[model samples]
Target: MSQKKPSKCKKKQTDEISLSKKRNTRAGNMGIGYETAADFAKRGANVIIACRNKDRAEAACEKIKKETHNQDIHYKLVDLSSFASVRKLAEEINQTEDHLDILVNNAGVYNVGNQLTEDGQQLLIQTNHYSPFLLTNLLLDLMKKSKSRIVNVSSLAGMAAKMDLEKLNKYNNFFTDYALSKLCNIMFTIELASRLKGTSVTTYSVHPGTVKTEIIRDSGLVAIVSRSIIRTLFKNATEGAQTSIYCAVENDLEPFSGEHFEDCHMVERYKSAQDVWIAKSVWAKSENVVQLR
Candidate 1:
């Protein structure tokens, strides 16, 4: 057998091929998250990109407009890590749009070392749970009018969590903190669904799967790991975004509100996530924390 050495052009082409594949597979772009936004915009749905970074959100909106040829995509500034910012974003959305057809709670933070928000709550809990909770509540009326769908970008981590209602502001372990917040997300989704039972609006929680996004880089520890190593462990953002997209546009899912999803399929969540007592307590505490009651 003859031994062959890879050519430089072949290697370059292979790298680009892999890069393109990874980009196409990320959950942020692949699944219903961004792609659905593009589709909705193309179909004349006025889509808004709620994000903390105005520059990035505008760039994304521009790309969507250019690619989808839909100029209606807009951006709203929101910092999910801060309750005040979330409120401002919700107010802006409410003031501008008469009806919001879809609200995708896709913004998230992850795996960072101990950090706190402006309100003094743990950052992950505030960003991944409280902010979204408050925003959804603030915009509930608009959603009701539009018969909107709220898709919460939850995580598999929630299943591994147990909530301690008394200590929402404290977490003995970092990963546990993330997991618990995700659990809170699921509980909130179910409770919101119950509240909207007789209304036109619906809510759902989804696990976007392990995705390779800037979030991992944002984590001080994980950022040290070689890129190649992390790439082997996770799908790109689009693959992680699959469930959100499915829940957003799939007609079959319209009747499946308040459910938990993974990889575009509805699945039962952790039993604790469905406990009415826990849900109520969390809801009360959440409202108090956000001052939304």
Candidate 2:
């Protein structure tokens, strides 16, 4: 693929929120991911919603098709905790789609416990960071076929995370693991942008603010007991999806490719996210973890 001139994304532009039949936008998860996909579908994009559950994916597709009055939405199954599953999803997309215009790595977990995936990695890390990293790498060729934007849904929790390259695959407490995974998402975006510099792909990390979603359903009693308060304080799925949707469809974002965004605007990246050395080191470690050749 030939490289396209990087847009002078110095000044952020308003949201376009439209996609043609030639552009394909894929988002993961069900909550904000669903909202993001629906918004794209409303604008006439070919949308694919990827997730682990067959029932949920099917239902989400059906609902989105009805709500958007756009029948182009579809679903595919993907277990983010498994490398095999991630690869399979990527393979299927690459084989079936002519080109990919946007990829939203929106699915993630929190406080999922100390268990490991079949891939022998911490469940949280695998689901939140490693699998997305591998999937992006696997789909790069297809994405490069068109001008593409890669959005990894990160979190504000990443601001509190301290980078420890060795602890990436090791599980500590739930909170610690979750923070680390989010930090890794930012690092992954930074490194991926550097690697894809002259290419047609631009990547970003986004914080969808605190949203009312099942992401916290595994946080045990505190989450259960605080559900009402959480709902009262957090943004709804559509509101929370603004930044991810912004990064995906907004124009002139190529110059800020590796930057972090929140509230639909580019904000200062966390101190840790600015560490290029650490970002490179994290990428190397992640490649080994995912066995990316």
List lDDT for all candidates, in order: 0.70, 0.85
lDDT of 1 by residue, 1-293 (tens): 13232121211111121111101111123233565466455555567777767677777788888987867777777777888887887788778767766778776666666778789988878888888889889988987775568888888888888889765688657678888888998889888888898898888898877766666555354466745565898766545655666666555355667888876677767776868778888889898998996
How high is each candidate's TM-score? 0.83, 0.92
Task: Please give the lDDT score for candidate 1.
Answer: 0.70
Clashing pairs in 2: none
Clashes of 2: 0
Question: How many residue pairs clash in each candidate at the backbone level?
Answer: 12, 0
- Model 2 C-alpha lDDT per residue in residues 1-293, reported as the tens digit of each score: 13343332222232354553446888854788988888888778889888989988898888988888989888888998889999999999989998999999999888777888999999889999999999999999999988999999999999989999878778788888899999999999999999999999999999988889888775468788667787789888888888888888776678888988888777878986888999999999999989998
User: Who wins the TM-score comparison?
Assistant: 2
The candidate that achieves the highest lDDT relative to the unseen native structure: 2
Return the lDDT, model 1, position 152. Answer: 86
